[model samples]
Target: MCDWNVDPEPSKEKKGRLARARGNLARRHSERLLAELYAGGTLRARRDASAVLAFAVALVVHALTLAVTAGGIWFIVRGWGGWGMVPGALLLALGWSLRPRFRQLPKDTPVLRRAEAPELFALVDEVAGTRGVDTIVVNDWINAGVGSYGVRGRRLLVLGLPLWEILSPQQRIALLGHEMGHYVNGDTRHGLVVAAAYRSLITWHYYFEPGEHDPLDEAATLQLIVDLLYVVPRLLVLGVLTLLDRLSMRASQRAEYLADRVAAQAASTRAALEWMDRMLILDSAAVTLGREVNRTSLNRPRGKQQTDAWAKGLWERLAADLASVPEREHERLRRVGALRAHSVDSTHPPTHLRHACLQIGEATPPAVVIDDERDRRIAEELADARTKVALQILQDGY
Candidate 1:
């Protein structure tokens, strides 16, 4: 992911001890990589031995899916009318689902076209230094980023509405700048082969993942046997994931530093610094996005009309809520972030380090400024989208 994936808290399922331990390890790994990179002053055109091995491992994972597919086809062809058909059928289904491929945008993904959002596209273009992105989109989130989608090398811009609604015009530019910067830097995770490989492993891991509870009619002993059988394979897959993550993230941390440098150029050093500052409290927006809708619904607006009004004003309410946050709270978040090394993920460098880097880096004027005219037009363009997202949030009750 190009961004902190929105700085949301780890999902409930991922809050287990194993996950926390993994996260802490990732944090430490990123920190060490950042320090090493900074000290080496080798910002670009460097790939360590481990990175090459990781690439090879990624291809192996990708090919394993293909191998499963081939094994299925062979069994089906060789044993057309025999007992082999049962396992063949299962393997076919599993292998097909596990195919390595780019992350395709959902058919229902809400998109903004150049024609529909000229002002917004103008800002995007400016942030990108006239580079064209394949898509600009919105979703229910408190984050934003640029990522590649599909095998054709198309780039996507996804703005988290809650994040967008709260940002200043310049901050918005900074956000786009940072994400766009990822394309310029060496974001190995965006690579088709590597990304697809990682995703395939994730799917495989999830598929064979042992259920916390057995099926109602299943025998416990049988389930235990099945689970025990999968334990070794699952552990092996997880180990590969950890190794790949560690290797790729070293480069990813360096890329983050480079992207921040680009962000500084795209939206000024001051804006980039402010961007890091805002990153510390992204959790607040995520929390508010969840609570605002549920709290409003709980308030029990009398009828459809009242509910619709509340939904329409959702962004305004969210913005106001953020505006009222005290500086002390901001400082507190910064402290907490520092304690955790201030990471968005294991891959990205800690916010404190990036912030300090920018503080001491060059100062520049913003390439694209967000004035009242620009802000008003972009907001007008996204008005329906904002309302729709609000309604979706209300409907989803999150």
Candidate 2:
């Protein structure tokens, strides 16, 4: 009377249409939210939503873990020698093993001080304004950010020295203003909680893996049972993690937009746009240049000075190449779009989109100017510190 079988697949065109519709919907939703946020008075709501979601996820995870542990204990007490006890004991052990560990903030990079680089320190102070920065560190990479560190919870402003070398004085000020904006907006506080939750989910997922053997190695029936037991639970946990991660990422992107607006106010909108564009170009070039440097560095045993010189030369060449690109070619480059596309998991918007937003904001003068004398002084301040940092990099063979 009734058909039990059903079609298991959809047409490819149907699937494509559904995917496009979903993409359009999501894009429209994000645009509306961004518009409201930029118009003002929505950041608090976004922050609250992020916090509540993070808290809810944490609560559910902990409650599930506790319930499993309690059930395990009950089985152990009621039937100590039975098969029920075995699973109960295993569940308890799993819960215990997967408990989140206190994470340590990494501290391998060199810390720069006001005494060592007064000019740079003065520049930082001017950019930072009233913000409190506990430490200033130089990293070897081509990105910069602000974050809290260690048990003492010191606020750190980490500058990528290489990126610093590439940017003009005004661009550097725009970058610093953007980073300080994170502190001003209380993003770092919310960020810590979200980061902890993400780390916990990641840890749980890792614990769900079948260790040292494939479930398929067993007989078909046993393998089926194992798959039903392990695979299903893993997928459920992964789904929850994906949902929570996207929520956190959306909050982060909002924070980035707000920070960009702050940069537009504190520094020049034009400088902010220029900084982002230069960063996009540098990021693309860094990958190829980094690979070449890595290969070349490994082939020879060189002193710190020599290594530094080689790295500087490579950077200079990369900069030269960027500068030599024609204006028309630069326009073509934008057609490829930003280095990273806007996505659910991405923390930053696309460069073009950021530029568009800044264009709508009121214009401001450049926050800082670098004359030849000022540039020379800044260079001198970094000279010794750069050598030391270079030596460290060479010693680490990176």
Best by lDDT: 1
Tens-digit lDDT string for candidate 2 (188-227):
3245555655665667777666555454665666655665
Estimate TM-scores for all models. Answer: 0.87, 0.72
Per-residue lDDT of model 1, residues 176-204, tens digit only: 88888888777676667778888888887
Residue 29, candidate 2: Cα error in Å is: 5.6
Task: Provide the lDDT at 53 for model 1.
Answer: 77
Clashing pairs in 2: none
Alpha carbon lDDT of residue 248, candidate 1?
77
Worst 10 residues of 1 by lDDT: 1-10
Query: What C-alpha lDDT do the candidate models reach, one value each?
Result: 0.76, 0.63
Model 1 / residue 202 / CA error / Å? 1.9
Maximum-TM-score candidate: 1
Candidate 2 local distance difference test against the native: 0.63
Error of 1 at 9 (Å): 15
